[model samples]
Target: MTPPGPCPRPLSRALIVAEARRIADEEGLGSLTVRRVARRLGTGQASLYRHITDRGQLLSLLAGDVALRLPLCADRGDPRERLRDHWLAAHDHLARHLWAARVIADGEHAVGTAAAFADGALGALAEAGLDPDDAARAHRVLWNLLLGHLLNAHPVGRTGTPRRHGDGSRSDFSWALSRVLDGVLAGQPAGGRWRLGR
Candidate 1:
């Protein structure tokens, strides 16, 4: 009888993602690469590729990890305020990870939690009286603004403490948000009880 070949290790993408997250959290997202992850895991880079297509895919996975914890869907309140709260919360969450915001900013990495968060945002805009197309466009615009703020606010290679919702930051964000809302919500009152995407 022919001898069996060497057994392959189990596919543990969760473990790979966890290690990648650690590297990103400690050093920064730029530091996270398949080579680094493989070296850290004591495996060949080819092995990692078997699970993750590329660094971009790994980034999406990392964003998915953070999105799972992101708090979306604000409680009942003035629709404008609710929308404001959701964005602030999102910013705070994305600020922690060096690259998650950058990755998710593409808006195509709609993994499980990310998609839910976006749905909540779209719903809020719809509730505020925007039609489906307008709500989608508005959401994308806000995402662009938010991702730009995050990428610029923190310098590259930054690590350590995540950003906090301090008074100045909060006030600034609130002001900016209000400006966009004023334009998008012009002549439209909040709390319209509308659904997203019709």
Candidate 2:
């Protein structure tokens, strides 16, 4: 069999990003490495450096790339449904790349796609009668719940394992997601009881 040829210089950056994303998706982000990506592309590490600076940059790009994959859409339903859809999309996206949740939580970098996502979410909340301040708070609440649930629902090395809920399981991620959305819509925090005062 002919040995794989080196990745051409022109396509190096795109190919590197694509390969990095594939590695993260199939083998979990923890497994993604510069060496692994280089090997997969049949290129030397130096070649990769021409396009990507380091592992941290590569991860940032990966996060941005993942964020860009989220489908942008205009508002269509009540704030509750819009928020639910946003949560589900974010959940599924992070679920696909378990490592991304950590990168995002760390606030390492911001990309246009992530910004757009934040805009959509805030727009929905604001349109639903939240002031800018309240919308921002709601956005934080939703994101926190998403990250926390994703971290627990998907453990390292357990990707693709179906969550068990039948037979009296205590952990129900879906149920919890719904309740969180409801709470957001009801003008309450995810884990807080309704109070008379602000």
Candidate 3:
């Protein structure tokens, strides 16, 4: 008789993503792989391909899963305060996942949740007086700032304070965010680009 194939129990993509996410949380995304996930699920790597083409696709799916946690902006509020809350929510959420910052930094993998958040944020910035193009640029700058802070503050496969100079405390983050917002407010003229002192 031929050797038995992988078990026939039905599997869902969501189940695979969940396992991948758990692995990421426990050992960082670098440790996440089709083989690892399959081992965790008591299945073969070939079985996983039915749900995900490869590790890259799985990572993109993971990115989207993480993005779901991003808080949406409210319909009404001072644009400055609203934007502040939006980014803070993002920072807090991404900070919790040790692997999230680096994964998100891979811009090509941007998915639905990330795109939705960006669209909303860009819309808020535009409403706050930035022209369309400037709003988009400001959004990019703000996002990079948050990603850099989180990546620096929480390196992969490590814990505790980030192994770098300077204060990485919540207060420091708030202060930095405030400064970025201030720059945006200062450069309020439509179509104008914001820049710090030369």
The number of the candidate with the highest TM-score is 3
Better of 1 and 2 by TM-score: 2
Q: Which of the two, 1 or 3, has more TM-score?
A: 3
Give the per-residue lDDT digits (tens) of candidate 2, residues 1-198: 564577655546778889998988788777899998997788878888998899988988888888887644357766666676777776776677777777778887676677778888888777666678987987888778777776564345344656541211223445666786666567544333334464
Worst 10 residues of 3 by lDDT: 189-198
Q: In candidate 1, what are the lDDT values of residues 149-189, reduced to their tens digit?
A: 66666434435565543324545566788899889888676
Please give the RMSD to the true structure for each candidate, in Å.
8.0, 6.3, 7.0
Q: For candidate 3, what is the lDDT?
A: 0.78
Q: Estimate each model's TM-score.
A: 0.70, 0.76, 0.78
What C-alpha lDDT do the candidate models reach, one value each?
Answer: 0.76, 0.72, 0.78
Clashing pairs in model 2?
Answer: none
In model 1, which runs have C-alpha deviations exceeding 4 angstroms?
1-11, 42-50, 105-113, 153-171, 190-198
